[model samples]
Target: MNIYFVRHGSTEGNETDQFQLPTIELSERGLKQAEVLANRFKSIPIDIIFSSPMMRASQTAQAISLVTGHAVNENPIFEEVNRPTAVRGRCKSEPEVKEIMKIVKSTFTDPDNRHSDEEDYFQIRDRAQKMLEFLSKKEERNILVVTHGEILKMVLALVIFGDKITPELFYEVKRTFVPDNTGITTIQYDLSFELHESGWYVLGWNDHAHFGEF
Candidate 1:
């Protein structure tokens, strides 16, 4: 199975470095990025299209849907990580922002002791695993998933490595593949169900070739 994971385009929250921006919509550049992505895969065969319920992800899926003629299916499990109440407030200073990130990273790494109010990492992993399992059973060769950066990272870690992801590992993966707004990452899954044996390879990451480097 060929799974194409796409991170939603830039949003006002992204520019502001906010975590929980449910109300933030896509920025102007994000719309253009979506169009570029859509045009890039206009002719590609996409069997299924899944997206986060968030507007950013849904809008991105809509753009690709127009090109592929596939409807976007909502999957709440693909939503971004929930932030802790203590860290919900927007930070003004650099040190405050760093503190918030530290808490966020802690929440991501420790599921049991996650923030005062946040979904456990285990829950996110299991939900994403179930979705991938469902996709694997299907005969479709191509699947498209539009979601947030954090969710995409979790899915990739679970599907590609089949192991609990540490913050260090996630950071390493992010550094290796800096997915831009509307960027696409293609991973080839072998017929084998085993993640270690599966010939999981990154076909592309943050590829904006369609946008002409703009």
Candidate 2:
């Protein structure tokens, strides 16, 4: 089974230094980005398309669906990781911003110790595993999912090193491979071995060649 993960297009939140709103739609640049993304997947044998319920991701999925002829389906498993209520709608330079970011980052490598208000790292991993299981069991082997940047990183960490990724290594990998808007990450799962074994490997990461001369 092969899964193509697309980070959602740029949102209004991406363009400004404001607090994240409850629902952010795509910016004009994001719409064009989505068009470019659609063109890249038009020739692929994409059997199904799934996206986070978030407006940005759904809009991007719609653009791809227009060209790929695949219906867009909403799946919560691919939704962005839930953040603490206190973190929302806050300015970027708030003093608590650093602490909030620290808390979110810790969730990537430390599955056991999370603040009460935020989600545990295990929850993110569980969702990623569930999304994988759901897609892998389907008859359609070629799949596309549009999701958020941070959660994609979490999913990749879990898929690559599972729950044992150290905090240091997590930063190293993320610093080197964070996905850009509409960036694509591909994973190939080999059926010959158990999932716990070396059965799956990333075919590519943060691929955005489609955004040429833009």
Candidate 3:
């Protein structure tokens, strides 16, 4: 089976540097990025389409669906990790949803203050593993997933390379596999289940040839 992992188009949060900004919508450039991706995959026969529940990913998936004619399945499990203060840390008072958004934005911008009360790395890994396990059992020949950057890196690295990912490794992966707005990563999966053989094998990463310059 072949699966395509795509990062959503650029959002206001991306322009301003935010982590898991749920309310942030796609920018004009972002919409164009989505269109470009849609055009790129217009010919490929995508069997199933899946996206994070967040608007950014959902919108991207919808745009792709316009061209591919595939129905999108919204999956909350694919949503970006929750970084709300109440969820992550011991807070004196519960932050308002907007306040939580601010905190998440701050966390991404200021890495020095990141992980103060962040979600456990293992939790993130386990959730991603569950998704992979579900997909492995599926009969779909071609699947597409639209999700966040960090989660994609962690999941793809674990599934493809069998590497023990560290913070440093995440940084390296981000640098090496920089997915532009609406960038696509393609991976081939083995039919038979085996340790090294059954997991993902990356065929292409950060493919934005569909989009013209800038």
How close is every model to the real structure, measured as TM-score?
Answer: 0.82, 0.85, 0.78
Model 2 alpha-carbon drift over 4 Å, by segment: 17-19, 102-116, 163-171, 193-198
Better of 1 and 2 by lDDT: 2
For model 3, how does the per-residue alpha-carbon lDDT over 1-214 read when each residue is reduced to its tens digit? 8888899998766775545457668888888888888888877779999999899999999999999889999998787766654543233243554566456545653546654555445666777777788777778999998988877877776765465656556556657766677878887778565556655677888787777745
| Candidate 3 residue spans exceeding 4 A from truth | 86-117, 163-171, 191-195
lDDT of 1 by residue, 20-98 (tens): 5565678898888888888878766799998888888999999999998989988887777666665543643458656
Worst 10 residues of 1 by lDDT: 85-94
Q: Give per-residue CA lDDT, model 2, range 57-97, as digits (tens).
A: 99999999999888999987888877777776566678897
lDDT of 1: 0.73
Compared with the true structure, model 1 gives a TM-score of: 0.82
What's the TM for model 3? 0.78
